[model samples]
Target: MLFRQLFDAESSTYTYLIADHTTKAAVLVDPVLEQVERDLKLLKELGLILHYCLETHVHADHVTGTDRLRQATSCSGIVPDRAHVACADRHIKDGETLHLGDITITAIATPGHTDSHMAYLVNDDRVLTGDALFIRGCGRTDFQSGDAGTLYDSVTKHLFTLPDETLVYPAHDYRGHTVSTIGEEKRWNSRFAERDGRGANRLRHRPSFIEFMNHLNLPDPKKIMEAVPANEMCGHLAATA
Candidate 1:
């Protein structure tokens, strides 16, 4: 397998590039519009064919490069089936599989950052957690129809079920840290750490966590007005306007 992790400073977004060793078929996750050229150059230099462009959610922070990527590489644009985006070329549901050569990517609905968010499991080893789970702190659940309780379940129930050694790659990180394992997060996660398996099983502390998140007076994303609507059409704002 071939993998690359790229970062965007304006939005603190992390774009991922993954490819199969045998066929050189590739896919990109959470690409930003500003970094499309860099992503394409890497693809060209590696002699890999772009097969898929995947989105975890319709972002409210920065515009997606999906439109430009599709135009440049002719890759299929995939999003969760429940996403409000009308421009997704492929609508994947939970448990659905996507193939790039022999590599398999499975969609796991992990909403709460947004109603349609999904974290993808790649080849059953690593998981691209998106904004659902981060290195230490999770995404703010104050907007975009976010629910703190659902996010708690997404982590403790769905994501934590993955192998403890599973590598976690998130979509954004304000800190310099780039990667972590499920085991590390389970132990040190700022919000949900220190709970036993049975505690997580009962969501023993989920309500208090949700209540805290609900009461947090966070500010709206800087680009929400522009980014959200543009991203809804795969970042082609004029197409809908």
Candidate 2:
């Protein structure tokens, strides 16, 4: 199996490229529209066939490259089940798996960043945490049908149950952190875990987490206006209303 992480500077987004070396079949997860050409060139140079473009959710931070990639290659555009992407070629549900030869990508429903978000577990080892759980922080729950309490439950009940050593690859990272382990995040992610007075990290109470999230007062993403609509159409600007 071959796994590569590609970054889009403009949106601070990370697109993933996962493929099976033996079959040369590849899938791009959470791709950004601006980086489509770079992604295509990489696939071509690697002698791989683009099989699918999988979106974690309908993004507000940046438009997806699925439509452009679908036009360039015979790839299907796949989105999370129930996501408002009417143009997607497929909708993947929780526990559903997509195979690229030996590579296994299983979807785990982890909403709250949006009403329908998914984190992909690759081969049961590494997790591609779209936007639900970031390295030190988590996604905001102030918009797009987001709920702070729901995000807390998804992270603690669903994501935190995975193996402690499972690799955490988030969709976006502004702190230059590329990857982390589940154990590390559980122990150190300030948004989910608070430091005790004695210097130990403890799981933050749900009420505290929710309260803090609700009062963040963060600004909306600059691209939200255009990005959301375009993403809903699978990145087809012309089709966006």
Using TM-score, give the best candidate's number.
2
Cα lDDT listed for each candidate: 0.88, 0.94
Candidate 1: misplaced stretches above 4 Å? Answer: 194-204, 238-241
**Model 1, residue 127: what's the lDDT?**
96
Model 1 sits at a Cα RMSD from the real structure of 2.9
Q: How close is every model to the real structure, measured as TM-score? A: 0.93, 0.97
* Model 2 RMSD in angstroms: 1.4
Those runs of model 2 whose alpha carbons end farther than 4 Å from true positions after fitting are 238-241
**Candidate 2 lDDT trough over 10 residues, lowest sum:** 232-241
